[model samples]
Target: MRKKHEAPLDTLNSYLPVGAYHTVMQYLGHYKVHLTITKERRSVLGDYRFAVHGKNHRISVNGNLNAFAFLITLLHELAHLIAFEKYGNRIASHGKEWKLVYGEILQQFLLLDLFPPDIANEIKTTMRSPAAGSCAEDGLIRVLRKYDRKGDVKKLVEEIDVNGLFRTDDGRIFKRGDQLRKRIRCLEIKTGKIYLFSPVYEVTPVSHP
Candidate 1:
């Protein structure tokens, strides 16, 4: 349900910081690329399409139509275009080239942070650990319970230990015995009963390197 000229560059320009508009114009001068924002289900947060005729950029806001997400999503998609234009997909997404460009634009041109303070802080924390899962422990539990049936839940009991906490890829932590109704799982504080309707991914303790 995305239109070709949905979010025109002029509208997007209004959201940019004072000097960012000029920088973006300079960066994307060659491709004749068009930026569009829509209420579509974007495969990724943003996407770049370069057909033989022209180029297009699409960002899926998913009703998070705030200026912050809009700006970041726009920058993220622009990073894709910049990467493809310069490197031609030779490197990984978010690889050295993309990261460099992202950092440069975010710091110098954008004159602001890449993400909001909380999200940026979370990213910093996530970079420290590599063994975390996609969602928070509670979120994972919720997904599991949604797919699991009644009576299939198992009870788990364990002692509270510093090592029992699970850290997510985004750096959010959940203790081993925390009661989560979404996942229908709870660890009996004394008995260490880990009750769950289904088996979710295991959370391994991170060993200090």
Candidate 2:
């Protein structure tokens, strides 16, 4: 029997979502880093690892992300590695130093060819005081989710009817309530505490459609 050979892991774009393959390939080429596409989780989307303890630098992003989201998350983690190289974690994880590096990297993608006007504009503002999570930037996530698969971004307010129960993307269940500005004040079914949630927070309705 003849032995079979396999393609290089770097050549396999099956780990990435559609439209992200070429961009990610270029990113890996530029950084000389290891990329890992992990199973989707409810809380965290992606994370990064520094070249420490004799291990090569590695970056992991959740599987099935839309192109824009994947790019943003990838760049976000890449900034951490870049910042660590410069500052050596002397500053806070999201302090001024890291923010500077993250901002500089994010600016590289701010163009009509890379993203739409709405997304680019929002990214400009987000870089001013970059949030810890991409989901924290309402406008940015909104635009990114448009590029996601259907049913990936069900609006909390719309998906779960008023007074209905739903689970947040982060795994918290809440009983829907009245609106408060752009967010809704819902009661956490577990904690019994009222929490304000964005009307557009990605969620899955607990009850049937």
Evaluated with lDDT, which candidate comes out highest? 2
lDDT of 1 by residue, 159-209 (tens): 224335543333434445443553435343444655452234434333231
Total clashing pairs for each candidate = 11, 0
* TM-score for predicted model 1 compared with the true structure: 0.47
Model 2 per-residue lDDT tens digits across residues 1-209: 21222324665465444455676567666667777775546556777777778767887777667767777888888888788888886767878888899898777666325776777788898899998874468778777777777855366464567899888666778889988777888888888999888776777778631
Model 2 RMSD, rounded to 1 decimal: 5.8
For model 1, state the Cα shift of residue 154 in Å. Answer: 29
